[model samples]
Target: TILGLWSLASMSFGVFMGRYVNTEYMQSYWRIRAAGSGLSGVDAAASEVASLGDEAAIISFTEGTIVDDRRTIGYVAKGTIYCVAPVMRRAMPSAPVEFWAAGVGCCERRSNFDCGSARLPGGSLTALTYTAEGDKYFAEAVKEAASVYSITVGKRAQRVFFEGDPAVFIDDLWREAVVAAILAAVFHFCTCIIVSTALQKAGVRWVGGARGLLPGDELAAEDMLLRGGAARGKDKSSTHDHLRNVLDPRASWVEEKPERSCLGCGPRHYWVFHSLEEQHVEEIEKQIWFSESRTLDQGCDPSFFDRVVIAEDGGFNEVATLMKSINWYRYFSAFLTVGMIVYNICYILKSDAHMITSDDAGGHMYLISETVIKPPLDFVLRMLHIEGTGRFNANVVVPIMEIACLLLVLVWVTVLAVEAALVEPRSRRRWKNLSRVLFNFPPAIAGFSSMSLLHYVNPSVLIEHIVEYSHRRASLEPVLAWTKFVVLRLLCLVIGVDAFLMKFRMTAQYINQEDIDMRCVCQLAGFILQLIGIVPVSIIVRERLLRAFFGGEDASEDIEEKAKEMTYHALLCREMYRHSQSDLDFVVMVLSFNDVDFQGLMLNMNSSKMGPRTSLEVKGNAQVTKKNSVEGRKSLEEDLENDFLEVARAASISKARRGARPGATTRKPREGRAGGGSPPSPICP
Candidate 1:
């Protein structure tokens, strides 16, 4: 969508530029042919050229005036070489000069004219447009040459002629228009293919499109195994009864192992399932139930939602830290946005629009009338209520600011996109610090806000001209504005619709997948709205920050305070997710009896007797591949007992020492610590 809009904008700009150039082509040049020999006709044409204001004339001089191997005067100023050769009536010591044939970079020697077809037969020069600066330079060059050759010249004879035709200039304008249209087409299709392919691969399907079932769906489908027992060659009643027995909590036996042979600890109870298949079936059912229940339960786990405030890791600490590290870029973007807004606005408000002017091939004055001639620095002056207008060109200054802002925003968006879209929420503990930044400043919003910076800093010539021209030309503004307005809002609408289509498939984690799509859709949207939305996205972001930290009061807070609040919010979410996962794991383990029941079975099973408890235990331990030999089982039991005793004794000693100390209380280990070691055994006192 962004590419389509960009293409349309490019094509529109090309058409506008082409039309403007064509109009100028009709009025900007005159065909002034020499009437007689010896430079007389050239002089007549130069004198009459003043009537056509801001227009150039092409002068075809007579062959008699052509001077082969003529001495050309070259003057270097502002890093541009201005060259001119004298057009004289005759080659005499006192010969009067008609005019100077002018062109840039046409002289090999500072003193000789070595440029173009001036020395060829039937050669001629084109007249240069009148300008105060160009006039001064020509006068200076003529003066410098007079001192060396001792030839007299006056202001009347200072008329300059450039060595080119105006027809080529018109051709270039049309060429630019055609090229721009072509480029826009290429960009549009390429981006469409890329975005479409990515979306398809990521499982974003159209409505009613066929797709493989999710993990949760497959588990839910397993209900058919019991419902249609004929598929498994079993009676439906028996299968139903078997499933019910497996699901019943009382069906699992509870065994209490005595302390003496176990680990010198008090008796501990463990669940034991009837058979391995029953345990496996129970695990699947619990998973399916959890999945179904979670869909209905919008609330987070009570352990997470019941908290009064978020922890440092929960949400706010990361936001706080990230704001500090990234705030300057945000501030600068806000400033740039303001400057651009003002520049664009003032262009509309101000009378006598300033133009971007350059010299064409014919040394004719080429003007880009649709440009903001007043720099951003000028706006700064107006804001400060300075005495005079600011002349500093912000074109150079603003782009530098843009570069700095772009780099920061680019890095921030990249990391955030990767974390939110690629990294799992639970697995993000390893990337906790970086993940905090992601949550605080979502990748979608960050990219959306910085879209202008991306557009402004882009080196695309067509976009550059469109931006510059759109501000100056009032006629172009409404059309351009409406086009962009529709494009961006339409993009939002498309994304919103796509999200709706995938609503059931999208989890909290997968919601981050929309970030890339949002970035692509909304990136150019910023550039489009810069004029209309005077309040930058940064300012809005700042407002959100203030609300999060200071409860929406119009009050200032320290960076550290904001940082703390932000990271606190981030960590709070993390903590909530942790609790939710805990609930899910608990639900699955309790029904399956795999977590605790296996411990008792491993401890009490006798290798010699194939009794009911021993047979059930053997069938339940599906993960254990090799049946332990009688000697191996006895040795394993002794080793497990010894290790359990050592851990229990250590925990007991630690508890005793804490009790003996003054004002020392038992402290639980921090949640989510990596490799904190298996929590003290439940058997420990």
Candidate 2:
């Protein structure tokens, strides 16, 4: 596919060059240098360049890549900068080469004189193909595309310039080669590619790109990449936005992994979320499961749960600390919410007098009792039948109503503030914790506050939090979200009518209808954006909100399921090693996995930890058995007595023999083969 794409792009470039292309543009560019070419040596070129000025003559290729965006060559020589082929301002920088300032060019255009240094005496373009392949394949390409040039520049300087683009036959091969390939790809695999990418982002395991299958260790564990059996190699600072890459003890640079031949290999291996074949599906499931386990290890490895009892004991305080640590953003949210409520109230108060007429008859305030107060006021007005009458004591009544509303906002904000402060310990510096809360007050005063509560939390922070609580404690979403939405609802109400009371200033009388409409749209837009964003983010975060809220063994089961899925999600999202050691045994012990289906996997990890009963308990038991073996001790004593008696008898016999044969010559040493036979056996009962 990559080759096809490259070929297609190459062909597109070819078609662009053929038939309709203006090679004259390049030639003309060279023609501009014609003014300087007439001069001889460095000084002459310099003088001519000065005379021509900067626009016509090339000054610097500091910005040009060796192979420029237009696939034209550029370089810096002495104090001169040259654009060998000058045109195609819209082109992108080509792939780089070891030599030259700008990287090498990609599109093969007959540049009149792109490589001024390499041009020959005759003003002609020269194509240089320098590859270890010895240019055998491209030799013909060179002959047809361009001629070779060898230009020499003396230390004394020289003025050699190209005149203009030369005439040439248009090449249309790019149509059949490039167009066909590109169209075929777009027609056949465009949707597939997009879908695959989307699924990959959603934590689905897939294999392609002509790479080998399941190359473990090549990828970081978090990515859940699989290595091709012992084969082809492969595979952030911000805490909120980054994946937990540091969790793995063993990490290696992905570049270090040996590249695998995906298409060139004997057979390609792949793992898909849902394979066409059931066997493939199962294999992918295993890979997914394996990857998932490693991903989980990034945070709470199963080891924590394996020793659940111990962890529970040690972790109690940590939990308290984590939950108690105020999000800080929440405080800001409350502050903003209260301020919004206050602003709304003030707008109502200021508008209380009534609508003023040019005729000088006092009237009811404009936009004063629209959304919240309209229903109650309308009823009273209807009963009094003074709906269209001039202003009454509404000025006096409205301030009291504003006070009530202000009081409610104050109470709500105060309660939230107290709870947050109480739960949060004041271990950190007062000022440091207050920084986020202190958020640009001047800016807020100048209408710089976020329009929505969703904006209050950083996207990264939200994501990290979502992932962090994926399988754990209950979410405080209801508590956290309600106040903000209430603010939303209030704003909506304001917009539903034409109050336009977004940030009511005490001095301001009425909000313009347009301002209200715009603010309302922005709020709606923000909501829509957040909603769309969560679609992808939710896949990655996968918080078990239900399990978090509902505490039970059933919820625990769901949590376990979510944990595995999230682990898999991490594998897909992160670029990590394929094979990381995970305590699958511990997972089996704690998680309610279908043992019948996972028996083999469970056994695999279980076997790794299985050898013998060597725990302290087992050793203590073994020691006790030895101490209680009375019969065995008696037998040991008998055996020792027999050995001693034999030794004593042999010593006595040696003494008797020595006494009888003091003069006897020492006997010749007897020769015997090892294990050939024992001495002649004496029959004994």
Candidate 3:
């Protein structure tokens, strides 16, 4: 119930916030600045700034004397860099520089303030301020910087501004979240429909109140009533006459037409009719009563059965063995995902893990790990003194995306495992609702990666700032590079997992051909995308890493093999036949269910051939037999037309009263009869 509510809430939240975040917040944050507007003039128009919003141009400079001694740098939580420099608007030497100009990424240290030609005209320019009305965090960073420099900034100048726009780096986070929500809804809906249809087909109405009466049982009752009605409608002749007419040679013969058997009835060899002689009717009734009693005692659904066909003496163990192997591989894949999660987390939290925090506040950064442990790539590149070059920007966006992908894969794998193991309708029904929130990952990953790549390659202000920021931090470049490579490899792994699951569905037959085909097409498309965008890149990256680290002679061969393995094509090809065999085995098991003895025989024969994962099938068969045992315990009234115990009780009571009467005539039995009076036993049909 919580999961369902969460699913609904997540979708609603995504759809609502996607447009809200982009239009309301982001739009307010980044807008075109009109030319020739002075900083002082903009400050004077602060009253109208709220109404104007993004439409008002705030990129203006204040003509004032720069006080570099009072400059200080501060950072926001996300590592945004800011500089607060005091500006004296008055020309008098006695005037204090109380007006502080906040500039992003313009001060490397507190003492050096290089914001917008301040030395040229002693005037500082502000592009965008941190003191946007409603956002207090950025203003705090600027305030802290001012405090560090022993300057109390005026209320109007508390805002931090940047010559460059960080909005260029801002991603549409809500849009991706919305897409994920919608995808989850679609998957959930499909799973529910498929599971519901399967339940209905099995004569179990999970959605309705009726539980005991099966479709087959109802049909059998209807057949019995029709036969009884026909018997009552027939004219009755004298027994002797009826027998004589049947024995006569001139009696007409009617050909018996075949009738389709209802569910659980199986096939019948002999046919019965209402128009029959007295003797024949009596004999038929006796046989029918015996058959009904036997059927009920056995707790069988089929009222009648034909000869059982023995299966050909061939081994059906291949599928079982193959499924066993797939299960091992599945577990291995799951382990790999877990390892990836751990590795990713370690990388993210590693000491000296370089993260670009603030884009423009003189390239402020933070070390995730307190100790400075540089990666091999960074260590090698450090000799070049790349800090001043401003070449590569360290970003956490792609890493965040990778984390999302990891979580998706983990959930997908877990759900797949749970679905395979569960047999109970109620348990599965509940799981089905929860699984609807699991969204498809490949498309979502693709969308996010594409956006990330676009940001990485484009030479916008944000990208430039990031590059400069990364260059300053020796370890940041390698970390970001390695993170990208990891993401690619993860994508390849996800495609493999999808292929594995697709095969699993094929074997299970839980879904129909069309659904399978659609899934296959989507998976194929995703695989193709992976090959195009992820695999080749991964191969190249792998090759470079190997060459860089090992410089082995067999690097090319290793790369090729690893690349093939990464896509999981080899695994798919090897297991394809096993999946087919599993389907065949499933068909055999289903067909053998018509004969209980043969079903048990097949189950026993194949039981040893299967591994642990196939135990669910054995468990299912056990549950069916258990259900039959339960069915056999039905109430006495359900099995008999009248209460036989009452009749027996009444007979015994009357006999006792007669024997107890005063002066009752009692005729003793002759020499052969030695027993006292005994009550008749109850006759139950």
Candidate 4:
């Protein structure tokens, strides 16, 4: 069995290795083919060039000259010049050579009428200019030019070229293979030993051990098999035949011994044969007994059970027999799973509310009023049933709720961590547990804070503010708005710094760790939070204003340009978010730059849209005439405006179809139109 299992595993590994080898071979073959093709092309060009003249004479083929071969003639030249054909000369016109030469000596050269003769080398000398028959000849010319400058023809071959070191590249690969084979052998030996020990513990024996069976033993085993029906096997016919042989005690068990021996040893070995035979008999017996018990427990023979009970004076009833057994642990686990889900949902909702109420209310309210006039605060108003002006108390209630939720989430996570630590098996060392807790703690805190923040900050409110702000401004450019965003972000930084100082002091008292200061932790957390808060706000502000002012085309173009700039920003954000232990200050510095860039994008967008327009006065007569064409210009502008509105409407529709928000619900077709299907029945009635 062990040998069979190992063979199967080895076969799978072999197949994977074969596929890898095949892919490598194919790639190498293509690379070699490409190199050969390139070399051949270069050789063909060199051969053509050599055919023009003898080695020494071919070198002196300067100034345009026709080389006359016995069969053909072709132009040979050494100095290059701009070659233009008669047809191309007119279509794509170039200034006369004299015109360029005239400018070299300023006015003096033109006055003397000797600009070309004085300025140009080889003065007034002529050369044959050949026009190719088609693009093919042009392509050939390019190839010939490239081959003339080939590095392979000019540079000396390296010392390692002819006497190559096979060991240089192949040695590592050879060593790796050797190491892998050794590791595989060790693993196989260890696995086999484990299997052998397990088999002995299970009371299993080798094939040759079957002879110790008593006379009626085979018949008893056969009866058990017959009662249970045929056992499952790789081959159904073999299973039936085995059962039949077991049923007949007189049937020979000698035939089974040879096939049951270990793969490493031949069946001729006495012990190997005996071990295999005994193991087969043991397996059959176990299967038969297990099947019989299952059949009895399933009440397959109800009448037989009743007769047995009457004989034994034990009462039986249909109701008592019909009760299905239940696994209580499964039910308990399911209950716990459901409870955990509910707890998480409640925790998330509460956390969101806390964040929404605290720092985000002002921005949230402003946005909500712009979009909806009166946005619902479900928890504050609906849950508490507080109506009227009390609904506006989110500003006051949100911060307290946020802080409370953050505290609760922290405690909850801590409790969970402690419980996990306690329940986990003691096999894992203490240091590993401490490392896991410490590494995971910050994210857990941040996550809770993030959830709280999400509830309070309304994205729609922010987006609306950006849009409104953009409409009010004249410039509507990204740069200026980005500057304003930077200033506002700086203000946020100042506030964060103050909060950090206060919290650091409070945290120090709570932790009571004199040596391990809380200031570091507070500073880190504050920095992270500030980044998370500022960056997203800047992006949101910038994106909205860009979209509103520039329209889709300009926005897309700007985004593509900015995407390259933002890659570093994204990396810094990742570093901060992960809180790498090394170079904390460096990471923070990088993050601060990204923060500034983000703020700049936002401020630029804001100022460009919000600032007053500057009008320029026309001084030139041509400019006055251009301005005088007002009626025509107004008509063109109106047309453009109408077209833009139509485009916007179309884009909105497309956005909706692509599953943007406000169009998330899937629409159902009418029954008659939906393949003649019946409509779904309503549950309300």
Candidate 5:
């Protein structure tokens, strides 16, 4: 059971990891892209700052402008400007005046016009500079020459880097995965232990001696042998003795004296014959008298009728019939459990109608507006509280529903564990009684209530936390994947073990030969089917269908079945509650009885019929055989013996089976029917 739970947890974790972790790649890419975009924004801010003359002074001049004019702080020649600083002293040599003058004089003075430098008070010479038509550079330069440079600046450009660290995020993700996996494993293990203990207790109850026949309770062999003779004797001495005598051999006296009935006396010549006839008649009369006397002594009294009726109505057979009726309830319960399991599987697969979004609504709305002027599936959306009116969000509702579904599944698993522990064969009465006690534990209700409370307390915040946690722990991808794989393997192992144990336990506990064989076959077939991939497929399919049909409620049933499956698996693997041949026999006897005093009756029978001598011999032989078998068959037989011994000891048996060699034969009994009329003892080979 633990393994199955682990597998399921692993699967859930894997799915969560896959869906959420894959998003990280996209998140990372866009984050870097956003950073790059922010850099472009900084460049734009710098250009704006430069254009506002926030970093440099700007001045401008026109061609042929005099140096003395206030607007003529600079001179322009050949479309170039020569600007002088106001506070500068000696020629302002860094200014463009000298170069501009030289160029103008060399080109223009030699041809037609005389070009001279304009003198400034700062001792700087100004002249026309080179120019180009439609030059934005010249326009920019003129604007700069006239503008004042600002020393103080406003806000600096905002810079954005990648929002988070990839290494740290990956590490956190890995840690989360490991923690989740470990928690899942621990939970599974604990659950399995609880379930197994509960089941074993139940088994002990069902086969407890309190409910079965004792050895002394059986009818004595001597009594059974004498009952028929005593009954026959009583029938012969009844009020109908005359009629009975007609069919008796002792009535020959009357038949031989036939002539005596016709005459009171005989002729002298035939006196001898007459005397003989009279003698026969007298004997016949005496015989009739004796028979009549005995009839009075053994008369048919009214009390006999009462005793006969009581005998007819009471006995082991009646007890057997009553037991059969009681067992039907158990069978019914088993069937109900199976049905519950199936129902749970169906509920988990249904999709929430409320999860639809605007993206899905667009095409349908467009078509509807062109035709009926109404939306398709609008009723469904409204019913799900998701009509795109911002009243409810699919992002929130879907996750909430998913968690609820998971909780439901867990609850169902608990239910299944309870049922299996209570119902499956073993110590049935004890288990049933324990089940009654456990019914009040209320774990399922408590869990559901807890979950509901959790849901009610700020669902959005809860979702955010979950998302953040998942994101933070995304790097444990390998661990999550590996956990899932391990869980699956464990599930398979559990299934195998459960099937085997159930088969063994049932076979041992059932009294009816046919039932034992049938159970064995069924278990074997189930195991084979599981091995061939049918069981897992069936589970998956059933879960899907159940989820689709019943929604959340079915999840409980799924959990129950899975738990039940796992518990049995664990029990089988652990070889717990296994029975020895004698223990098995005792359990069968208990299950077969209805009366409370059945065990006592069995004890009585065993004491009287199986004498001390025979008992001692049987015990001695068993011990020897057990020892031999244990030694000879070290692998198979030893394991089988060990399992049997464990069950026997648990059942509180007085002695263990004798170890016997495989090929050894038993000695023949003396003073018994020819060729030994008894059948072989039903013990494990």
Candidate 6:
């Protein structure tokens, strides 16, 4: 969640600041400061000087020529003229109209060229846009609010200003900053709210015990156990009668111990079957009933769920935190855009669309990187390596891969769209719908193309599946979910390489100063944001991944961690799953009501670990195995076949007590088990 906030904050601040300031402002400031030094200082002298009409024009800086893309033939020359005056609709009757009338080429123009902090000389006046040429100026009539002036003091050139009130530039910086803060807040809240829904559905409902279970679930679990009796070769009627007698609440001789205990969600709860293999529904239902009934009789603590970790554990925050690492990639992607933004700002700094310097004309590419983007694209001659100016741009391979990927995506989108427009929801879903996925892809790809800052993101499909459920993972969900961090890691590597090459090239060409400034500004904010938010979230992501994939140094810690996953799935698939909007209900729906067999898959995974066999073996438990039993069935295991199936079935009881371990076949001498009982070795050794 914090990472989500960081992503939004950096983007918001960067965008607003970029919009408010540009090289145009820098160029104007540089010129004026140089002028002010000559007249002693700009303070009293700049305000005292004002030029009206053609008087605003001065001799050319470099013969009045500005470069277009820094090439000689790009544009012809003009003088370096400064226009310091207010914007007006028409020229005054007294002064020359040619210098004031800009031929309507200007209206609400937006570019880096327009931003400036310079104030007009002496009285209030601000410079307006030039029409067709830099020498042509327009002063629109305006009253007081805020004002600006473009004052340039070259070594020999003079300062020119037109007098009137111009007040549009006051306190603009403060406004942009405020908007960025507001946007950050909006983004934070929006992320929190959307992710909350996914969390609510996947909460820690499977923490064994009577917690988070309804009354009916208990009965279903009891039934599940009774059905498992046939696998033991007992007569159905006799097993039913025997199970009934043992389960009776009023029977004095009825065992206080549940007949089944398997590796499950929490500590060895009696009602949860402790078998190595998944049991039938009847056995599962029976355990649920028995656990609930026993919990009721014992008056178990109602306060177990009171702890925040116990109640709100294992939900949105966990999954979303992992997903947030993706933003590191997005951060680098945003960094690449600085190069282009700097290029545009430089364009505004030197000259506009009308004219350019002679020395900088005749170049084919903008920003002086012609060789970077044009060579391989020419189609006439083939070159594998771009050696000169084209070196800065992507090589031939990048575009080829990009095109192939783009075509693949286009085909997917087209097929999905047709399926959506022509078929029913159920039918369309069969072929993989693009509704959730394709919606974000178009914008993401566009951002990739233009190198724009992309902040649009959502939780992955795997996270969605865990929160909801579907038989088939959404078409692209597994890819995104499983590879979330992998992609971020890859992007970080790519950006690092690109940054090195770009810095080397830019430094050599002298075209990288503006780019470096922009990148530095963006990164400074990014680094600060990471310190405040992303760092903590990244730790959380790393911890979760480590705990899940690589167990801590201790061996038992491995089982404990895997147990949580098992328990989650167990609670998810309990028989009465549909009744309470429970975990299993979500899984069933995600599977599209068992169209795909997650049960076998989940069972194989859940029970695969050699789970803790005794109460002592499980962490957070202080005591040994304590099973108060029904006397008659106590010796019942002595009569079984002790085959593979039976061994696994009997393994649950092997760790419970010394009495059950004696008849249990092929038991291993597990050293630390409660009451010194050996755990069952399910496989023959």
- The estimated TM-scores of all candidates read 0.23, 0.23, 0.25, 0.19, 0.15, 0.24
Candidate 3: tens digits of C-alpha lDDT, residues 488-540? 54444443333233223323442435334544454444333433432334333
Q: What would the per-residue lDDT of candidate 4 be over residues 1-685, giving only the tens digit for each residue?
A: 5568867976776666555544533333333233331211111112243232222110111232111111111112343221111110122122111001111121220023221122244432211112112334333332342243221221210000000222232333344445555676677678768877765444332321333333323433343342232222224445434433332222233333233444533232111112323434554444335433333333322111211111111111211221122135434543443453344434434434544544544434222222222344444566676666325543333335445666686676567557645754432333233323333333334333322233223456546545545654425766777577545544434333433333334334445653334444544444345335433453345456435433444343255545532432333233333343344333232222223333333232233223211111111112222222445335533543454344345545655676554533323433455356654421110
lDDT of 2 by residue, 1-685 (tens): 5346756865765566542323423333334334342322222112233344323333322222222223333333343333333211123322112122111232233343443332334432211112122223233322232233222222322122222231221112223434555665575466556665664443323243344333321232223332333222331123111112211111121111223654443222322332213333443344335433432422212222221122222222232222233344534544554464345434333333232212222234454434356566667887898765333433343334434554564465455445535653442322222221222121222221112223324457455544545544335565555555456545434432222222232223223342334445444433333233323332222234323322245445455665543443222211111121233322212121122212222222234334421122222222222222455335533543453345335534755665643453322223473555543321110
* C-alpha lDDT of residue 605 in model 4: 27
Per-candidate RMSD vs. true structure?
29.6, 27.9, 28.3, 34.4, 41.0, 24.4
**Runs off by more than 4 Å, candidate 5:** 1-177, 180-351, 355-358, 361-685
- In angstroms, how far off is 30's CA in candidate 2? 19
Question: What are the lDDT scores of the predictions, listed in order?
Answer: 0.41, 0.33, 0.38, 0.34, 0.32, 0.32
Decreasing TM-score order of the candidates: 3, 6, 1, 2, 4, 5
Roughly what TM-score does model 2 have, to 2 decimal places?
0.23
- In candidate 1, where is summed lDDT lowest over 10 consecutive residues? 351-360
Stretches of candidate 1 off by over 4 Å are 1-40, 44-56, 67-69, 91-98, 122-143, 146-153, 156-685
Query: Which TM-score value belongs to model 5?
Result: 0.15
TM accuracy, model 4: 0.19
Error of 6 at 341 (Å): 22
| Clash totals in order | 26, 35, 19, 43, 81, 62
Candidate 4 stretches greater than 4 Å from native: 1-8, 11-242, 245-403, 409-685
CA error at residue 677 for candidate 1, angstroms:
44
lDDT of 1 by residue, 373-396 (tens): 345546778899996684443222
